[model samples]
Target: MSHLAIIPLLLPLFTGIFLLLLREQRIYIKRTISGLSSIALIAVSTQLLCAVSDGNILVYSLSNWPAPFGIVLMADRLAALMVLTTSLLALFSLIYAMSGTDRQGRQFHILFQLQLFGLNGAFLTADLFNLFVFFEVLLLASYSLLLHGGGRKRIRSGLHFVVINVVGSSLFLFAVGILYGILGTLNMADLAVKVAHVSPENIGLVKTAGLLLFVVFALKAALLPLYLWLPTAYSQTSAPAAALFAIMTKVGAYSILRVYSLIFGNEAGPLANLLDGWLLGMALTTIIIGSFGLLGSKRLRQQVAYLVVISAGTLLTGFSLNSQAGIAAGLYYLPHTTFATAALFLLADLIVQRRDQMEDKLEAGLVITKQKFLGVMFFVLAIIASGLPPLSGFLGKFMLLRAALEHPALPYIMAIVLVNGLLTVIAMARTGALFFFAAHAVDTATNTYIKQSEPEPLKVRELLPILSLLGLCVLMTLWAGPINSYSLETANQLLDTPAYIDAVLGKEAQ
Candidate 1:
């Protein structure tokens, strides 16, 4: 009965609505409102996490309706963690936006809040159909945000993004329709129960629906074949949007983890482990492709985009193991990649801002102001992204590899992951050298180092958000012990299917 589960959804919902009603000219007020709302979101999400930290599954039935009939907002450790991650990222992204990026579009604040609303709701919703609704909400807000600056690159990428997601959304609805028609319930807990006992005649339809859901989630997660739309869309979008999008791919990974484990899990009789065979192979392929993309990228933003793909592939690989340790490793790595990738995007933009004509291209450009500071930041991020020692990325990847030691495909998993890490290291080193070390005078005879003009002085306010994100990565590394312990507990809770079912549908139903 705790209301905390619903607050994460409601706070942003109302905040977005209020921001929409305000006049756009009152820009300062709008920024203040949006910033405060994001801060409040962090607080509320923290409370929700604390509430569920003790193995509690807090479910709030809409309108006091009972299970399987009512729409429910369920906050378990997993959902709470995701909500918190989204909130933290949103706040930092907003701070970065406030540094002039928000001016690039109309109603930036409103759309930002709406996007948070959708993200928070998507994490907390317990019903399958409501999940689709939240997906649309987030996608709608993202379409505008992606094209916020209004340029040819953004438009082209936005159109591709829009078309792909629309098709994915259609697939999601079709899958949901099949599930509801056959199972008579769209509540995930109920579906889990019903899917286990599905009659033989309907098994084919159920399997079809399940595979369709997997495809939709993979498309969202940007798994290979369906990931064609992500690099362009993500790399071309504004920095703040790109940074916020660091968590977007994780949503697909999260859905795959949730739906596959809960509904078609080991207890699903014939449908048990339906996706197990395909997930590992696809995940490895995704990693390989992403590694190649990193080497192939000609720009910093695009390289960062490919890194996101690799992270997703790694995450799903862990989940594919279907073991507690593997899932725990993925959970720990999730936030690390998110923070690190986002920091890189923000930093890339900062570097591009000072390069004048060169932007983020991986070619020699005029040396930027604050070269020393930016160089150090990029170096730290590079180490983290490449999964080098003493960082959260390394620890997370280590745990995953350790967890996979017993799997039949251990060698392949290790090979792909380790090789990807090496490629990432090479890519990062090359990018850093080009941006920081390769700069030379534009006029050799005159020995002119500056661009048409010296780039604008670097501002502390602009660096603050990027630094904050990096600081989070550092803290995550320092606090790995407790964090990993928590991840393990969450993994345990996730694998405890009966507990989840009983909590949602009551012990009688289970």
Candidate 2:
């Protein structure tokens, strides 16, 4: 059972190395290998999740060394669940890319595999320094993937994304250095124990380091004031890449949950509740900004990108409450948002491909082929993204809102969330009307401007991935009871930081 902890990290690392040796022309071989590896990852992550579901924490130490001294990987329910979610998203994204998008670059397969490797590593590692290492690995892969199709807009957005992250990475290193210098340890479990015992005089420095780390994570999570890069960058990227990048923001949310719950949590004395006011205020503002962005977006992809921001704000709002119920709701909301957002990205690309010359613009154009099928898909996704009833989105938001009622800031958070949902519905409805109904104007245009041709029908290969993602959202709605149960249990485990520490560092640490 302990050995299984390393398989998630190793699977992608070895596959990525193997892919580097293959030539660019061997597209079929590359696709086969990538697909099989992704399936294997899904299996491995599921097994790990089941193993940890019994409220057990599995730890694997490298080279026979242990605790605050050597590298370690820890898998608890939250980590395993996150890994499984990531694998599922990766598999579908890879399938979507194989429909001719992978040809835009020479080493798409290799970069994709490396991205998985980094994400898995970041989730599994129990050391802060190694977390930084994995972050860089993933960012490097994403930078290349962002510019894969090589358009001027993509390149320009990619450059901004890269520069901002580079600065974030530098801050990450500085924070880690400060902590290591003061505490003489980088292992999370050890740091948790050491931070509790820090002298009062030096505690200020510890708080500063912890807050700096939060800033770094906030940049990744696209928290307000640091989220300007996401809209342009995500809107301009290839569909498959944008779908996969959905999980990247969750990585930051996961980090915030882990670090705050374990290290600077109630056990840290002065550091406890350090993030409450700031995180909550910023989160509500983020929701408003995202909602306004969605309403003002002029392109289909850009609207979806803003939806991503809205999801982030919702998740962070739940997390900021810093209670078990709130965290559980956030956990339940995480996977639902991930699948829905990814599906929208793929669906947008399909819609764009079917248009004659308008190409995803929010204005009238030639009628799309497969109009009924696409209309149904768009409506279903809109409901899911906008938190309408009969879908998981509504259920998740209900949980969050119900949990928020117990907090002191209930009125503020609840009002913002409700308004955001209303704005989202309006934006989605207007966009759908423009895409499906406004095409009637084409018949009235002058003869010189007339351009008529039957749009291409949707392909099975392209449609499969979108349908799979939507099906997942429906499944989530059907199984909400069990999923929420697991999320609640996961939250219980996270709040009980002492058990996590003891599991990783033995009984003496507790």
Over all chains combined, what TM-score does candidate 1 have?
0.98
lDDT of 2 by residue, 1-510 (tens): 269999999998889888888855579999999999999999999999999999999999998698879999999999999999999999999999999999988789889999999999999999999999999998999999999879999999999999999999999999999999999999999988889888888788888999999999988988898889999999999999999999998988889889988988888666776687788888889899999999999999999999988898899999998888899999999999999999999999989887857888998777573468988999999999999998999999999999998789999988999999999999999999988877753455563455567667777868898999999999999999999999999999998988999999999876
State every prediction's TM-score relative to the real structure: 0.98, 0.98
Clashing residue pairs in candidate 2 (N, C-alpha, C atoms within 3 angstroms): none
Taken over the whole model, the C-alpha lDDT of each candidate is 0.91, 0.91
Candidate 1's C-alpha runs over 4 A off are 443-452
lDDT for 370 in candidate 2 is 45
> Which lDDT tens digits does candidate 1 get at residues 1-510?
778899988898898889888845567898898899999999998988889999999999989897889899899999999999999999898899988999876688888888888888888998999999999998999998999989999999999999999999999999999999999999999999999999999999999999999999999999988888999999999999999999899989999999999999988988998997899999999999999999999999999999999999999999999999999999999999999999999999999888877899998867574568899999999999999999988999999999999999999999999999999999999999998888776766576664456668768767888899999989999999999999999999988899999998899997
- For model 2, the superposed segments whose C-alpha errors exceed 4 Å read 441-451
